[model samples]
Target: MTQTLALVGAAGGAGTTRLAVEIGATLTRTGRDVAVVDAAYETQGLADYVDTIEADVTELVTDGAPLDSVVQPAALETPGQLSLCPARAPFERLARAKTAGAAETLEKQIAAIALSHDVVIVDTPPVATNQAVAAVDMADRIVAVTPDSERGADALARLSGRVRDVGESIDAVVANFADGTPQVADADTRVPATETTAPSQCPSCLDDETAFAPAVAAAVEAALDTTVELDFETSGRLDGLLR
Candidate 1:
């Protein structure tokens, strides 16, 4: 069965999309059919990251566009390749993307995409959005990405509760742009917290050598209690360092 994983940003600039791209890239290197879906209709960063604006998830859900028609391959296709379904419309159209039955519509669409891909990594908007609620609802696994700050911690706490109220739980929480400072919360021991490397200045820059992908893959493996082979250098065109 295809694994549907959603990476949600607990706070703004949490590097959620970047992590999704890296994880998708890593999975592709392991020979898994991976498709990263941008559910964050407002930002639409995944389209630019993959260098393709051909079609987006908006088309899939609103226009009833076929999966193949919406999914476009990443710019660099080597060592296995990652596909992306981005948002075609701008932020204002997000309301239109939210279907009448909201969660149900998005879930069905996401499930259809899952049928064709081995792994579907969803990059969701902030926790407050309806798109995020649907993404979390449809995902087989949920990974929260946040900065190592009080704001991120508080946002995560609320987001976790929101999902739990809907009968779901966060599988793991990744602390992006972490500086090893003591701002993370220990409210729950069951939920695992991990850290990812971030540049001193630009936290959004994508770096293949960073521990981001490995950390996320590790968190997923630990949460799911299964090993997922991830090679780190997939983006650099270098041989993958298996973990």
Candidate 2:
């Protein structure tokens, strides 16, 4: 069976969506089919990674759209497929998608996509809505992504407590845009800041030169409990780099 992983943010603007796309790209490097599902309805950042989203996660859960039909392939040319189920809808539809009944539909849609993909990765926001709760509760493994700061560490603690309330615990933690986070020094993966790109372009992780790719590969490994053969210092600290 395909294992589901939820990469949830500890706070707002934690770079969760970018990290999710990089993780999916890294997994695809190993010939693994990945489905990048979006539960961050508020941000809809997953929409940036793809060219366009005709049918999306919001429609899947709210209007009962066919899950497979909505899963558009990410604009990547890797050996393995990187499909994205994004949320690019109006506020009214988004509101409806966040309802409890729609959350249940989201949970089922996740399982439905898992059948076709080797790994299902949900890009989740902070657990504030019913949809976020559904994603976290349905995931086989959860990885918390936080900024590398004192505030981020505090938020991570809160996220942990919230997960526990729902009978789940974070399997790992990733500190994005790390710049000497003494507060969260023990984060499972420390991702350095890299150059930003347009949402319509390919992910930077596809490049073999940058440290960003290998670091994200490390995060993917830790989050999914799999090995990624990349040449980067995942065990050391690379501070002062922009994410």
Per-residue C-alpha lDDT of model 1 across residues 183-218, encoded as one tens digit per residue = 656321111123433312222213445545455555
How many clashing residue pairs are found in candidate 2?
4
TM-score of 1: 0.78
- Local accuracy by lDDT, each model: 0.67, 0.85
lDDT per residue, candidate 2, 114-187, as tens digits?
98999999999988889889999999999999998998899999999998988889999999887454457558
Q: What is the lDDT of residue 172 in candidate 1?
A: 72
Superposed by TM-score, candidate 1 places the C-alpha of residue 125 at a distance from the truth, in angstroms, of 2.1
Q: Which candidate is the best by lDDT?
A: 2
On the 0 to 100 scale, the lDDT of residue 135 in model 1 is 88
How well does model 2 score by local distance difference test? Answer: 0.85
lDDT at 242, model 1: 18
